[model samples]
Each structure stands twice: as structure tokens, then as C-alpha cells.
Target: MHLVYHNLRRRLLKYTWFLKFLAFLLLVSTAIFLVFKIVPLLLKFPVQLVNFLKPPQSVLRTTSGRTNFILLGMGGAGHEAPDLTDTIIFASLNPQTQDIVLISIPRDLWIPSLRAKINTTYYYGEQKQLGGGLILTKASIEEVLGQPVHYGLAINFTGFTRAIDLVGGIDITIPQTFDDFKYPIPGQEAAIPEANRYEHVHFDAGPQHLDGATALKYVRSRNAEGDQGTDFARQARQQQVLTAFKDKLFSTQTLLNPNRLLDLKQTFSAALIHDLSDAEILALVKTAFFNPPNLRSGILDTATSSGLLTHPPVSARYDYQWTLIPQDDHQLKDYVRQLLFGQ
Candidate 1:
């Protein structure tokens, strides 16, 4: 009877020990499942991060250390040939040195064998329903200039007007009197009669207050007299418009006024197509204001801008095209490098 009692006690103790061990194992398993599985699902926060919480870097910057961008302007939805990018500007920013540079390519710039203007590459891509004008144009510009654009903003014609209006209009100084008999009338040409739609527009020299439509015409009209009519003049007008725009955008009133900010945000959000997220844009704006850099501007076709870009000889196939092609890739690369990097 003593031996039986001893064995029974031993069995009971062993069973109790097993039960405790099992309970502890179960607790650990529950913890592992909670941490490795359930917790991640509950958090659900990987996609929304911009560069995974670090500030966004410039798109132009390369892994090797160069940063630059291409800015394309097109006619937006509801405009004829909505994808035709009329403006192509390359920008470079050296973060280490805080130097900023911009160079403009005329819409008449052409690439060989594509039967497409460099400006229209995006449009052609969109027409094919491939849906990546940004990619197409970026590639073409790189091919043409021997420089690549990592970051880009493709603003439409309507966006340009709306952005100006949102900023309460931009003030510009017209350097010369000019006129365009062929300034395009916006809206549906198919719906409206041709005679009623097309009208002669005039811009007088001197300080002028311009609303959106007038502002757009002021910079874009290439048929005006003096420098305004020439490609170089139009580019000058474009630079002027950009200066005015930057001033207004960074004005104390615009920056301080909540209503103005909201309006501007709404207008730009609707009008522009860009790779930038809200956070990235904010970071860029902060950089622009907090660390304003020296801005240098250039146009590719100007006589002083390396002189490699040239109009085609009077050939029916090329002359009627009205475009400029680089004499050699080497010169093109050198020219762009000088403009972008101050090299």
C-alpha cells in the first residue's frame, strides 16, 4: 500500500509538470503569431511611405551623383492634340553646391527617323494608347541632347492658365510690341466657326497686368514683332513669365494666406501631371523658399549657346519640317553639360 501511494503521487506530479509546460508553450506560440502575423496586418503601412519616410530626392539625380529633370508642357484634355508637348525644359540642381540651371528646347526641335518632333513624342505615344507620354518624351529628349531627365512635370495648356489665375495673375514687362494674326482660339474648333474663333492678338511693350489667357499668349506667341516673334524672343518671354510666377508663388501674402494656398493647391493638383507626391512637393517648396539658389537660364538655339544646333538645309523633306538638329552628338552633350552643371 505504501508503494502504490508513492507511484500514484509520482504520476500526478509528472502530469502537473507536463500541463504547466504545455501552457507556457501555448503562450509563446500565441505571442509569435501576434507579432509576426496579426500585428503587421493591423498596421498596414508600407505603400504610403515616400522613399520609406526619408525626404524625397530630386528625380534628375543619378546613383552616380547627378540630378536633373525635364519639364514638358502639353495641351490637356479637351484641347486639340492634347498630348502634344509644346514646352520642353531641362533643369539641373546640384544639392551639394545649391546651383540651379534651366535650358529650354524649342518645340521645333526634331529627332531623326521617328517622323515625330521631339516635343510630339509624348503625344505620339499617347495616340498609340500606350499611355506614357512622360516616358516617351523623356527618352527622346535624352536621345536628342545626350542628357537624361529623371524628374519631370508635364503641365497642360489649361493648367498653365489656371495656375496663373489661382496665383491672382502674373505681372510681366513686355520688352517690345508684337502681334499674332494666327493666335489659336481655344475651345472646340469643330464646334465653332473658323472665322469667329481665330482672332488677331496684340501685346504692347511695358509693364502689364496679365490674367491667365493674356499671360499665356504673352509667353507663347511666336509670331510677334522683334524678339517676341523669334524663337529666342519667345524663350525670353517664357523666362520672364517664370520669374514672375516664382515671385508670386513665394510672396508673403500667398504663403501666409490659407485660402490662397488651398486654392493654389486645388488648381495645381487638377491641372498638372507629375511624379511628385504631396510630401515631396512640400519638401521641394520648402527647399525653394528656405534655400533659394542662383537661377541661370539658356536657350539651345541661340547663337551664343555653343552653335551646334542648326536648321536643316533647304530640302523639301527637312526644310518644311522647320526644326533644328544637332550637328554632332559630342557638341550637343558638351552644350547641355555646360548649361546644366555650369561645367
Candidate 2:
């Protein structure tokens, strides 16, 4: 009977050892599976979360590390030839140097192919298609500059005023007091008395705050005496207002207020046209924040001795239209290069 009890104990010990070995094999198999398969699944959420937290970039279209935009400003409804873009600015941004150059393209510059002034290109294009105006404008500008244009933007005079007002107006320092005796009154172009069609507008010298209507008059006044009467002066004033408006728009007070942003968004939606995506715009904002731009400006003018362009003699070939043309077509490209690159 004692021998029988010893044999049973030995058998029980062997069975217990076999069960322990099976348990060890199970643990080993599970660890191998987790390392090869289940671990990736567990890590996926964290990887995805990290990606989600990353800031967005690489949205803007660029050429040779530079981004170019064509900006157009038009007289909105209730003005004669309202679709005509009077202000054409070529805005180029160099990301590495944070240099922004604004080159003003003369509105009265003649385009032989179109048989019209460059400013009228936008109008004719819009008559052809819905967004063709900007496309044509970009193409024309590219042709003149001999470079690629990445995008186009357009805003009308009405939107300009509303935008200025929304930002509580902007301050401009007039270099000299000027008067525009022939400033055309809106909706009075066909008034019976030709003299009554225009209203005299004046501005005092020194720094002053301008509301919407007053700012509009300030920028649109073209018949001021002496140097102020020239288109170059007009372009300078436009650029000045643009700079002031930009400063006001990006100020801390404007940024922190949600209501102001919403209003400005609505105003822009109503008045502005562009081909930029939200991501692209956000990228621009990000770039500006990280690298503030050094602003520069140039105007293509007909300054008798020191200008890139000159006025052609009166001819029926151009419908006797007063227009400016580059003195040397070959020199235009070089001039634009210098204006943009300082090279």
C-alpha cells in the first residue's frame, strides 16, 4: 500500500510540470503577437493624435521660393465703367527674406493685343466668363513682368470704405495740402450741368484720421494741383492708405474682438474676389507672424527723363486714347526685375 501511494505522488508531480510548460508557451506566443501586430494598433492613436496637433503648412503655391499675387481695385456699382480696375498692384513676397514689394502697374498702360488699356482687361474678361477678369489680369501682368503670377485678388471702392469704417477708420499723414476741383461726384456723371457733375474735395496737410467716405475721397482725388495731380502721387496715396489699413486690421484690438472679425469677414465676402483657399490664407498669416515683412513700393510712371514709360503721340491707331507705353520693351523685364528683386 505504501508503494502504491509513492507511484501516485510521482505521477501527480509529472502532470503538474507538464501544465506549467503549457502555461509558459501560452505567455510566449502572446508576447510575440503583441510585438508584431497588437503593438502597432495600440500605438496608432497616439501617432494620429500627434499628427492632428501639428500646425498646417505647404499650402501656398510658390515659384523659386517666391509667392506672387496680383491685386486689383475697382470702382463698384453706380460709377461709370464700374468694372474697370483703376488700381493694379503686383505684390510679391519672398519668404526667406521677408521682403514684400508692391509695384504699381499703370492703369493707362496700353495693351496692343487687347487694343485697350491694361485696366480695361479685367472688364473685358469678366464679360467673357465669371472669374475670367482676375485670370486675364494675372495673365496680362505676367506678360508685362515676364514672370509667373501665382494668384489674383480684387476689391471694389465700396468695400474699401466699409472695411476702413469697420476698423474704426485709419490715420493718414498728408505730405502737403492738396485740392481736387474736378473730383467727380458719385451718380452725378450725367448731371445737366457739366460743372455740377464734380465736387471740389480738399485735404489739409499733416496727420489726420479719415472715415470711410472721406478716405475714399482722399485716395480717389486725381485733379489735385502740381505733383499731387499725377497718377504716381495717386498710387502713393493708395499705398499709404493700404499700409494704414493693414496696420489697423492686424492690431491687437481688432484681432481680439470676434464680432469685429465676423463683420469684416462679411464685408470682405461681399466686396472682395480672389482664388485663395482658407488654408493658403492661414499660411500667409502664419508666415507674416513668424517673419514680419519689410515693405517696398514702386510705380511705373512717365517721368520725362527718369521713367521706364513714356506717353505716345496722339494717333487714331489707339483711338486717340491717352496712354503710356514702355520706352524700351526689352528694358521692361529688367526694370520689373530690379523693382522686385533689387538685382
Candidate 3:
């Protein structure tokens, strides 16, 4: 028995150096994960992409229900039509029922009040430096939807690319094969004459593993052929990419990977614009854990049966360009309410 004990102690002593090395490695990995992952907490709460940030308001109740958000996406500064609101949508969440819906608003929507595209409301606001566009967008959308929005999140094109890359990339289904012959080439390859900057990009039909650049092109390409050439097609693609990326971000693989989670958390904190306080953010985390929301989505555009119609400019009405007009604003609002609230 004494001989057996001595042998065991000798073996442990012989492996002590390796055991200490493993312990040291574990310590380093943990520290790295915490530092990078907890950056959002360390830097300060609610990282703002825009400057018009104010105290967060409570989740609003509509005649239909409570908790709605407006999400706007744009080209930001470096892309063409830097101010164009490339994507506009509303997200409504019911913490109690764990139901969430995303409703896309067409970028071509014409606002008679502004005499410009609804998407342009963001552009005009930013061009005028009206607190960087969030306030103006929220007010205009609330007027249109007849519902109050409690929060707003706007992500630019650059942000999208960065986020997709940070998550290590995303997988998507290309509904059909298509090509864009005019995708603007950037960097030093930028054409001296804007017209000469076009490049052809082809996306094959079916499932694809897309990196940030490929994903951006998939969603943003409008100068393609057949059905792929339409804004409605682009909207659908955007939603597909959005859904895929959301799943990737929330997937077990991403969630379980400490490094990816850390990068994504820090990346999105810098990329997204919102007024959610730390407590609100924590509550959201809790809600998500306790009751995961079922995501439902819809598109509002020229393609939908109850969608907007192309309105020719009328000089008398101060309409000056091509825009999509809702036949009846009140009716549209009611439809949206039913779609979002089912009430």
C-alpha cells in the first residue's frame, strides 16, 4: 500500500509542469473572452451610432397593443446615395406572449407631407443635421402607422458588413440565379467616371455560404435581370439575409463560442443605434431566455396584393418624382395593425 502511494505521488509530480501549463492556458483564454466579450459593459451602456440619443421611453401601447420598434437601414457615408434609407421596417414584440413580427416598409414610399420618399425622410433629416435622423424618422413613421414606436435601431451598410463578418459569416438560400452587371466597384478600383465603375456579380441559386461582401451584394444588388431587378425582389433578399444572420447570431454554435460571442457583442454594440438602457437590455436577455420569441415577417411593397402603387409626379400636388403611394393611408394602417397585432 505504501509503495502504491509513492508511485502515485511520483507520477503526479512528473506531470505537474504539464498541469500548470494547462491551467495557465485556461486562465488566458478566460481573461481574453471576458475582456473582449464584456467590452460593451466596460465602455458604457447603450452605444449610440447617432447623436440624437435621449432617455429611453417606455414600451408604447397602441390601440392594438404594446411594444413596437422602427428599424432603418442606410448606405451611411461612404456608399452611393449615402443618405438613402435603403431599408425601413418595424418590429413589434410581445414579451408576455413571446411573439415578434417584422414588417418592412418600402423605400419608395411617398410622403405627401414631406413631398419626398418616406425613405428620404431620413436623408433630409440627416442632410439638415436634424439630430441625425432618428427623431424625424420616428415621427414620420408613427404618423403613417398610427402607432407609437418605443425604440429605433438604424444600421448602416458598413455596419451590416462588419456585423456579418464578425459573426464569421452567414448561410442563405438564393431563391434563383441572378446577375448584377452594375455593382459599383469600390476602393482604388473605383472608376474615375461613375458610369465606368460597374462590375458583374453572379449569385447561383440555392444555399450558399456567404462572407460579408458576398452577403452585402446579395441583398443590395438591384441592377440585375428578370424578377431579381425589382425593388420587391431586393426587399425579399434583404429579409432573407436578415433572417439568416439573426439565426447565425443566436445559433448554438455562435452562442457556445466564446470568441465569436465576444466579437459579435462588441461589434453590434458599436454598430447598432438604440436607446435601450442596461436594465432594459438585461430584461430583454431574461425574456429571451425564459421565453424565446417566435419571429414572423411580412413585406409591404408593390409586389404584395395590398401593396403600394406607382404614383406619377403631379406638379399641382407638389409631387416631383416617381414614388409608391398607398391608396388609403387609414386602410393601410388598419391592415398593418391586424398583421402585427391580430386585433
Each model's number of backbone clashes? Answer: 4, 0, 0
* lDDT of each residue in 105-152, candidate 2, tens digit only: 778877877778889989989999999998998888887777689988
Please give each candidate's TM-score: 0.69, 0.73, 0.70
Question: Across residues 1-343, which tens digit of lDDT does each residue of candidate 3 receive?
Answer: 0000011112222221112221222222233334454345645645421111322123233334457777777666667777677777766777667677666666766666777777887777777775557777877778777777777766666766776786678888888999998887654245677767888999999989999888888876879999999876876787677767767766777667877766655655555566554445544544444555676654443443433344556565645566666666666666666766676
What is the C-alpha local distance difference test score of candidate 2? 0.68
True lDDT of residue 264, candidate 2: 67
Q: Is candidate 1 or candidate 3 better by TM-score?
A: 3
Runs off by more than 4 Å, candidate 1: 1-61, 129-131, 170-179, 187-197, 202-208, 225-247, 277-286, 302-307, 314-320, 338-343
Q: Score each candidate by Cα lDDT.
A: 0.59, 0.68, 0.61
In model 3, what is the error at residue 331, expressed in angstroms? Answer: 1.7
Model 1 per-residue lDDT at 19: 20
lDDT (0-100) at residue 184 of candidate 3? 78
Best candidate, TM-score-wise? Answer: 2
RMSD of 3: 17.9
Quick one: ranking by TM-score, best first?
2, 3, 1
